[model samples]
Target: MTRELARRDGLFGPIRVLERKHDGARLYCINGSLQTLMLADGVSAFGYVHAAKILVAEAPNVLIIGGAGGSLATMLATRGHSVTVIDIDPAAEQIARDFFNLPPQVRWVTADPLHFITAQEGVFDAVIVDACDSSGIVSPFDKPGVIADLLMKACPRGSLVVNIVAEDGAPPWGGWLAAKLASLGLSVCLFRSEEGWEGNEILHVRVDGPTDRLAITDLEQRPPEARTYLMSLRPHVASHVPVPATSDNGAS
Candidate 1:
């Protein structure tokens, strides 16, 4: 069972907050796509977010290029990582605070990600590209050149994690993206559900990190649930060769 907690027209389209009665999990949906899910205590409820967290656990500073419900930012901030989230929609920040319980410590920047990346001065230890809208990955992020620029400008020596939604067990652009980034001298890894493409596919790319394995740092500090989820994920280095593009999955 679920209840509609709030709804409003947002820049992307209709934005909504919904609560699941059984688990008290809150969902933030934009343009009919489920962007975030948070537990009652404000922890991320998505497995892919937890997986991404593990990939960046060693990094001290993190930049997330999409706000959504701010779950990823909140999770990182609570873990003592400095986190900044940039989104084009100001309403995303407001709704995240108003309904998703986004904490005050996470810095919120309302701007186009491409513009922010070009003008930003400070470098982050890790950068996550999770930007998307109703159709799919928003503007320039869908293109490889923009992502390459983001790496050059904001995270020259850090990690870049991208969240890709998949359909029928494969991401439309994951294989190609992995190959592209790898060609630029970055080690790339892909993480997906063992059960198949039931959720988001996470791509972890790094300039100087090992591609062989993912290690969970400060494991003792993680909550029992987070520890379990983190330990369950399997990550493998992405192929340097690009796979044929699959049909686009509208949104998730």
Candidate 2:
């Protein structure tokens, strides 16, 4: 059985917090999209993007661009990472703190991500662009330049993680997003979190050449969902390869 814990009239639409008896996860939903989950303090799964932090390591200072349920920030903080989450909606922050139990240490900044970074003091070791809304990808994050800004704000020896929804016949980002990311002098690898149907993808990007960070192989220590995603990245995923189109031409 499932019950709605609470709902807020967010900027996007109705932001809901739900409790499911099956998995006992606190569901965070917005704009009809399953946004995140708060399973335990600083531990979360359920949502693909919320679990993508498995790919990031050694990032003591983490930046999350969205604050739907503070799942990402919670997980990172639980791992001893100092995380700062940014969101323009105050109601989202309230729900996160009230129902999701947002960690007390996490710096919740109620501001646009694009402008928030401009006033930052130091760079983050990792930046997660889980920016979204009820409709889909939100502004600034929807614009490619804003992504580049996140990278530029990252430490040289840093990584950038992004959540992208994948569909059967659709190009995740027309492959241009990957290209755009690579132009920032980083190598991009994606973990396809597919489970029967096409699932969302997490882009784990790191600066090329040399670094002290561990390889993607380190993902073995992550949760089952994240492990499955990591293992799916066999050789490497260069871009969002769309399913080929079919033609009406008759075949003999």
Which candidate leads the pack in TM-score? 1
Model 1 over residues 9-95: C-alpha lDDT tens digits? Answer: 888789999999998989998777788878888787666787778778888999998888998898888889999999888688889
Model 2, TM vs. native: 0.79
| Residue 37 Cα positional deviation in candidate 1, in Å, after optimal superposition | 0.9
Model 1 CA deviation exceeding 4 Å by range: 133-136, 169-171, 216-232, 240-252
Residue 124 in model 2: lDDT: 85
Best by lDDT: 1
Q: Give the alpha carbon lDDT tens digit for every residue of 184-244 in model 2.
A: 5567665554452325656666666422223455554554545555444432446544322
Q: Where does the lowest 10-residue lDDT sum fall in candidate 2?
A: 243-252
Please, what is the TM-score per model?
0.85, 0.79
User: How high is the CA lDDT of each candidate model?
Assistant: 0.75, 0.65
The CA lDDT at 18 in model 1 is 94
